[model samples]
Target: MLIGEVARRSGVSARMLRHYDTLGLVRPTGRTVGGYREYSPEDIRRIFHVEGLRSLGLSLSQIGRALDEAGFTPSTLVGDLIRKTEERLNREQELLERLRTVDAAEPSGWQDVLRIVELLHGLGSQSAARRLQAVLAPAEGVSVPAEMLAEAVLTESDPNVAGALRWALARAGGDGVASVASGMASEDVDVRRRVVLALAELPGDEATVVLTDALGDPDTTTRRHAALALGARGVTQAVPELVGTVLTGPNDVEAAELLGTLAQDAKWADRIMSALVYGLTAHAADSAVRMRLTQALAEMPGTTALDTLRQLSRDDDRAVALIASALVEKLEKRLDDELGQP
Candidate 1:
């Protein structure tokens, strides 16, 4: 069979089929004497597998690897594909249940639509509230017009709606969502922020570019969300940017909190401690930054972080002093127990 035949039978575009071929996802098994690509029965089987996996949210890369790893077992791969789809379906059903409780009539379906938009995009907030009324309509049943949903999903120019879509894409959680998030990353600030958050939900090679792009977002809140998302991925590849976020991005409480959580990794602890120390130095300069950083450092577990907090207690800054003294006292008790008995 030719590419056209594969496209017709699989319901994938001819161009996309060609692209998939280049990705080595679904390749022709042979070629004709005239040089046209010749696909085999085995190739057709693999094409269906590729289509099924693509539907279930597997990336071309993921599907190709899975195909190779599964040794092309049609039945087994189908089951695996079904399981992945089922997981996403379950999550969507949960969202549907929550949607029922969230009074859609209260505000023209703004919040409910926005939630779906967020799930579609990755992250959003109330300021984007007005934008939600358009994306989500008040429909009781699940049978929304595909074109209506697609138009709402794609045509809206509202930054908030774009952001909401990014959030929704994140919640979508699969290769398909990752692809959508990747495209959304190039949008405006609010949209990009949502895209970063969405990428966090679907962490993959596609996410790497968005996360890196987010580090430079001018909006402090967006940057904070990006930092938190990167922290959750725990991508060591992201350590440098995470360090930058801690040291200079924005004086945000949530970002600081995320940095502390990320410090649990031994590879990241020294850098986290450095950021804490820098934040402490500025404690005398900015009270708000001081308080947030102090709160952040206290939550960091283990001796190294605790000891640093103890030392900071000696500072003239009262917030720093209080948290450090408390943590040090706790550490002392732990040390005594560890060293006293055996």
Candidate 2:
């Protein structure tokens, strides 16, 4: 077949076929009397082969090596293509996420779009300071959408930057609650923990509801944080976890203090006291735990807690006895003072 016939039948353009010939990718196998290029059957087959390889993202040089080099294997080149394709796909995905975030911001104009983009870039920067600045920079005039801040709060690992992001999310109010709440379903313990912390800072029934649900999280840290946040919100449902926190610790003091505050409510007072007393009884064999529980009892109000304190004041452990006795004295003195005793 002549070049024209080859181009017609194979759909390879004449110019590209000539270029392929010049590059020795698919040279014509013969020539006619007029000296025009003529392609044999094998040559046309090679042309198809080159086009086939190009479809797989092979560069011209790589294709040349693939076609001509006897030692060249498709395995290594195909592996490289897979990696590069994955990288391109990841880049596209990130771009799409960024676009969606920007669109969610509902920017008013090109300037707003640019500012949000800049803020996103800064948040993803390698430098922690830049991330911190990106979170705080919006206060100058730009209004960062709550969803964006919630996303940052979920992924941030730096303590200072994470704190700022939480503050910013909180200041943004209930708008970011859904975004932060989504992180609660993550299988990662740290992610769930971070979500709880972020939700704790956020104010609204939405955040409170999510924190209440998080009370059942399998991770202890996540459960504790959620319980504390719910306790502060006066949810009363946090009593179990807060009491458990008192029995076994990480933030036992804080938990105890919140339990004390919760006990101030008349309806929850006995329930909270009962849970604390149970902890004291259940953990009687563990002196340290008993001691912590004893101290936590000091936070409760009403005669029940005072009675519990009076009973613990003569306990088996000398340390528990001493601490409970001291707390008993303080509680009596405070009670006396309330009653206007001399």
TM-score of each: 0.48, 0.85
Model 1 over residues 269-300: C-alpha lDDT tens digits?
A: 88777867776675557665565566667656
Task: Report the number of clashing residue pairs per model.
Answer: 19, 0
- Report the C-alpha displacement of residue 92, candidate 2, in angstroms: 2.9
Please write out the lDDT profile of model 2 over residues 242-338, one tens digit for every residue: 9999989989999999998988888888888888888877877899998999888878775557888889899999999999999888888888998
Clashing pairs in 2: none
Q: List candidate 1 segments past 4 Å from native.
A: 1-179, 182-187, 216-221, 237-253, 282-284
